[model samples]
Target: MGSILIKDTTREERERIVRESLGDGFDVTCGYDDAGIDYQQYIDGKKELRELNAEADCGFVVAHPEEQQKGCNNI
Candidate 1:
């Protein structure tokens, strides 16, 4: 609801935002899940959530003829 910009939020707020967005994938006691680890940049204020989400969206499998799996299947 409020601003999620790095300058606008405290480190704690950023952590809470990422954790809540991830739902059960995150553990308050154990920390980030494998999928959740990508948000570390957001938590550290090195990047915004939008930037991270954009990177995720842009993900694609590169062609690797050497591997049995090719293209999107590589993902």
Candidate 2:
């Protein structure tokens, strides 16, 4: 119910915001980590959510493949 801007929130708030927004959506595929988004920057107040989201939408993010999981389809 308040501003989530880096300057408007604390580190803990930023952590919660990022986690809640990305909850259950983090995986080897299509994940912020795999997409090379430094979400930690947001938590550190060095970057904003919009910055990260923009990177994800620009279609130019580098992909880092994760190791294959045995018997795991992420289901």
Candidate 3:
């Protein structure tokens, strides 16, 4: 597994980078920080939004930079 730090970046860019890095046979798991918002509420809101657009698996979280650093270390 590999990870990269993205500052002031868009979701599309992140997704593209992940896809390219993992190649065609890998499953991607995306983690983010919630920025201190209510997790369930945000998830519900995202579900509703996705329902409106026929999308799926939409939500976010505020990730600790330290934790991300640890993840990178593990990699």
Candidate 4:
């Protein structure tokens, strides 16, 4: 797995940057803004968005396994 940090930008801009950086080969997944007002209307909104985007755009889903497993022994 690989990761990239994007800062100092609007949500749309960040999305564009991530899309451009990812290029046209591998699938892309965005794991930012889960339940923020601009993202979605529910918790786990990030996952929901990822699924929607992956289905509609054929991009890979983005997720932080370490973060998700921080309090668990599933790693």
Candidate 5:
């Protein structure tokens, strides 16, 4: 099991990703940051977006932009 990191996107895009991020028997969790307010708790209809903040650009990130993949599978 692993995680997918999505950043620098809009709510519509995020929603789309979230929709596709899940499938039959597949489990995935996703969330983003709005300025300083984390969105994981608010995504998936858990919360609603009242105001759109222009400063938000996926601040709550999981993997870093320069994060390296440590795949355990050997060739």
Candidate 6:
């Protein structure tokens, strides 16, 4: 399982995709089933990601700023 995308969908549609893509829904919503998790932060981060994607589709997103062969050169 490498990079993937399931673009443009509502929450219900995302749920269906989760059920199909992963038998579990851990990555579908803002929070996973963890005890004492700061759910507000999780939700806020998810919102931020959505806003960023909306702004520019995050085409400029990067994990590495240089080509030193560091981590996850995947994109």
Evaluate model 2: give its lDDT. Answer: 0.70
TM-score of 5: 0.25
Question: For candidate 6, lDDT tens digit of each residue in 1-75?
Answer: 421233444445544544564466355445333332322332333433333323333235556668556554333
Pairs that collide in candidate 6 are: none
lDDT of 4 at 14: 48
lDDT of 6 at 22: 42
Native RMSD of candidate 4 (Å): 11.3
Once model 5 is optimally superposed onto the true structure by TM-score, how far is the C-alpha of residue 66 displaced, in angstroms? 29
**In what order do the candidates fall by lDDT, top score first?**
1, 2, 5, 6, 4, 3
Show where candidate 6 strays beyond 4 Å. 1-7, 24-68, 73-75
lDDT (tens digit, per residue) of candidate 1 on 5-53: 9999998999899788878667544534443436778888898877666
Give the TM-scores of the predictions, in the order they appear: 0.60, 0.59, 0.30, 0.26, 0.25, 0.29
> TM-score order of candidates, best first?
1, 2, 3, 6, 4, 5
Off by over 4 Å in 4: 1-7, 25-27, 30-75
Error of 1 at 32 (Å): 7.7
Question: What is candidate 2's lDDT per residue for 1-75, written digit by digit as tens?
Answer: 899899899998988877787785553233375557778888888878777766654455335446645653232
**Model 6 lowest lDDT segment of ten:** 36-45
- For model 6 the local lDDT of residue 58 reads 23
lDDT of 3 at 2: 36
Each prediction's number of clashing residue pairs: 0, 0, 6, 0, 0, 0
lDDT of 6 at 49: 31
